[model samples]
Target chain A: MGHVDHNTAREQLETIRTLMDRASTYRRALAPAMTAVGLIGTLAGLAAPFVIRDNARSFAFYWLAVGLAGACTAFLLMRRQAFAAGEPFWTPPARRVASALMPALFAGTAVVGPLVNIHQEGAMIAVALPPLWLVLYGCSVHSAGFFMPRGMRLFGWGFVIAGLLSALAAANPHQIEPSIRMAHTVMTATFGGGHLAYGLYLHWTEKKPTA
Target chain B: MNPEPFPHLDRVIHEKARLAIISSLSATPSLTYTDLRNLLVMTDGNLTSHLRILQEAGLVALSKSTGETRPQTTYTLTDIGRNAFTQYLGHLEQIVAQFRKTTPSA
Candidate 1:
């Protein structure tokens, strides 16, 4: 037998080990759950102008409903996927993802109280809300994406860009109504549309006979 | 010039299959028997033999759960196994580093 170079052998072993570890992680199954979140966001965005119709309180409640539903969907779907894969929901990779996600989400949640307080005091904080939420959410997803597939990072960047644009458009005092509509539209496109696209991509690319 | 002194490599982990198993187990929290077999692309008999050897050596732990319709067997690296693998890699790196220091470039 040919003698194996210790360095080359070590490198090969490391590569194999990394590939095996990645394969063992839960990736593909998250697609459907993300898609569900996106769909709910899209529906909320479409209904916002009609249902809330310039009532900031209703708008806040509408989005809160959507957020709660999306969170539930994500949790249930992820748990199901983990169970189906015969892996624990609290695996090392899952914990890493949550660790990356939680900080940004918590920061966003902290901002919500102050934003709502400002809105109740009748300052036009509504215009700033969506963009801030989107940016933070994007950051959360982007960081968590490090533990997931390579393509997920792009979605995070997409949200950040969408958020910045939303902020810029809301800068005009006379354009508050338009900006609200635009924000909802952007939320629908990024969260709802982005998730559906990601899910579909995963389904097509990652579908294979499980070992 | 004389070749550098070789580092001691753990023979138990020197085998490719066992090394692969240990490396995989070290990375993940735990792996089912089927998952490990598929990852290594080893036959049932071959994998079982290797796993048995590692178990006997106190390097691996096998847990069987009977909650499912069929009992599920999962494997995890024992602390001893983890230390052994770390030590083995350290030795391999030292050997490589020494070889590079002594050998002339092509």
Candidate 2:
């Protein structure tokens, strides 16, 4: 039988191993940023009715705007793999739901307030907006047999935990108090910092260019 | 360690392809079905048959997951697989070492 080059074969095996590990790490780092914004948007959605209990429709509308945006972002990133190249295309677009988007939507909605003449129950509907959007976003991102390292799974579990806790608090009067922030922090760290750490660890050990 | 006077490759651990698979798994956390498929580059029926052999021999482990889209399978070396691969390397090293002492290379 022809002989095998044991030494060279071993080296090739090691090099490939490093590359796969690094790719997984890079995937981890970006996952959290995408998830956190969507998560907060969802929470804000669920909280809208309770916060602005009197104007349910207005609240629902605002939440709906945020939630829809999150779902769209998830669709662009996860489903289509549009920006998977890790270049400028990979960077997530400006989040309209959380910081500027919410205020802008609120202002726009308020301006239209007299025209629509939204009552209190109409305002309560705003709270459901983010959750509804988030549900859609989650659905869009959900896929089977997609490759994910253990780190991604950890981040996902964090989100589920956050959502459940937030729901429990939302059921009570003091839903907005402490647990929400904790969930946000945990989710951010687990997905953002967690992914970056995973990436760096893999990069340091890896022999090839994983990015 | 010295090379055994009667050194024969262990059947379960000695085959080159299976050895290559275990060696690859030892270093990576896991390899996907497609990744291993492309790496081995054997026909589906052939790879499946070999993998089944290794799996039955308890030198490899396999798992399957159903993602929202499709089912993905992954492979990893078992603890025994790692030990066997390592021992194979060590055995090769001893053979070279013995050869070097008994007869210097030209």
Candidate 3:
């Protein structure tokens, strides 16, 4: 058997600790996924008002479809990246991220049905859906931030703050009237513009692993 | 006097490269060959030899999948490997604690 000294043992433990941290770190390149989602969101937001008009039900369905599309696009991009890196798409860390994001995202989608059904009487509630969606989406991202890179939490906070501010503006009678168009505008500013800004930032700041 | 913890350590995982590999695998579900190489900054031959040693000891499992262009291989620690790592950590902590006991604080 190989003899080990105390100094050697301590050094080995420290090395193990570092290797563990590096192995668990999230290394996936997010720029592509973020940019793709950003483009989709911006385009969807711009086209929403023209296509859906004043019908609250149509508005709800349109945004839901857009959200679904954005999510699918991100998923596909991530899968492609995993393959390119010679890694599996559904690793344990990936599972952890999905688990974290699922609850808030599910709530955001589930509430849409009831909110649209009551749209005839509680039109304000329907108008408020954009902020609600923003908060829920922010919370989802924030929860999933544990398994992601550092900036994700801040990005999540941006959505949360935007949602709260939109809610405040809606509540102020002196502010612009709460309408479906107003909702679309809010969504456009926060989801569309926010994603684009963050995506661009990531593209610029992303560090390439050296050869 | 404490019995030497050195003899108790898992020899297969006690070497520098093999220990690093085990440590990395323990942290995540699995890693691809390229991923491990990049993370450890190790050469192909060195990594392959260490991985083979672990695989032979049943401390690691390897899987190969046919991709569009080529075959991709991923490696994960076996249950025995995880258990050994946990025990190794416990023994290391005991050694550290024993050292602290012998050497009084300044």
Candidate 4:
């Protein structure tokens, strides 16, 4: 028999270890938290029309409240999941996810200030902001999927596609009302429905197998 | 063939099991004993032996704390260990690169 190749063995072992590390998803990504954020998004979308009826100015603040609530929900749930897992919320994996996601989020937030001002001036620029927000959010989520599960990337892509469509609709002068409704529907489906679906999937699949 | 392509390979960290253990610990800030065992898929005794060797070599540090119900043991790579691992990986990469350069193509 040929002698065993230590170098080849070492390389194989290293490859396996690397794969395992990459495959290990961040358990603290909290599906339930995502679902909560989705619920909040749905509620906000439902309330947006009534709250901002005939007043475009209130649109910004209403969505801002939704964003804040979603952020808080995600943060609290992540903290809880981390503690339960006997790890810190800001672990190496979590930090990687955040690092990947932050640039897009910062860009979105930065653009919002200008967009809100334009909207206050009664310009159509404000109409396009929501989809822009979605596109940015989708980019962030897609980047974050690198450090998360395989399915997350698909979710991210869904947001991106929806964002593009919404933006297209918003750009059409004749399609403003339908476009606004479409944006809300997309928001509800992506944030609300997406979260619930993914959360339930995680809860079912990730639960420890009983002996 | 070169007489010694990897003269500086740290023998203590070169073993397969020990390398795996060190590599795993290096990726995280700290890992519990159970976490390591499950990750490496090694028996308690096998893992303990490797951990002991690394611990003795000052390549890994163990911290023990009482959880709400029981004591927990976690392992972290020491700064020295981190440097050593990085150096070892560099050497391995060099070796692989050299091998690829010299080997005839099929």
Lowest-sum lDDT 10-residue window in model 1 chain A: A1-10
Worst 10 residues of 2 chain B by lDDT: B1-10
Residue A15 of model 4 has an lDDT of: 65
**Docking class of predicted structure 4:** acceptable
A best-first ranking of the candidates according to their TM-score comes to 1, 3, 4, 2
Q: What number of clashing residue pairs does each candidate have, in the order they appear? A: 1, 30, 0, 1
Better of 2 and 3 by lDDT: 3
Candidate 4 residue-wise lDDT, B58-85, digit = tens: 9999999775445678899999999998
All candidates: TM-score of chain A: 0.82, 0.36, 0.88, 0.81
True contacts kept of each: 0.19, 0.00, 0.56, 0.04
For lDDT, the strongest prediction is 3
Error of 2 at B47 (Å): 1.3
> Which ranges in model 4 have alpha carbons more than 4 Å from their true place?
A1-25, A51-54, A121-127, A172-179, A207-211, B6-12, B41-46, B67-70, B104-106
Best by DockQ: 3
How do the residues A37-116 of candidate 2 rate in per-residue lDDT, one tens digit apiece?
44545455445445643444444345446545654655465434323322222222222112323443344345434433
- lDDT, residue A157, model 2: 46
Q: Write one digit per residue (lDDT tens) for candidate 3, span A1-211.
A: 4356556668778999988977876778788888888888889889887776577787788888988999999999988877765556887778888899999999999998888887654447657898899999999999888778779988998899899999998888576877777888888888888888898999999866431
Superposed Cα deviation of residue A178, candidate 1 (Å): 3.7
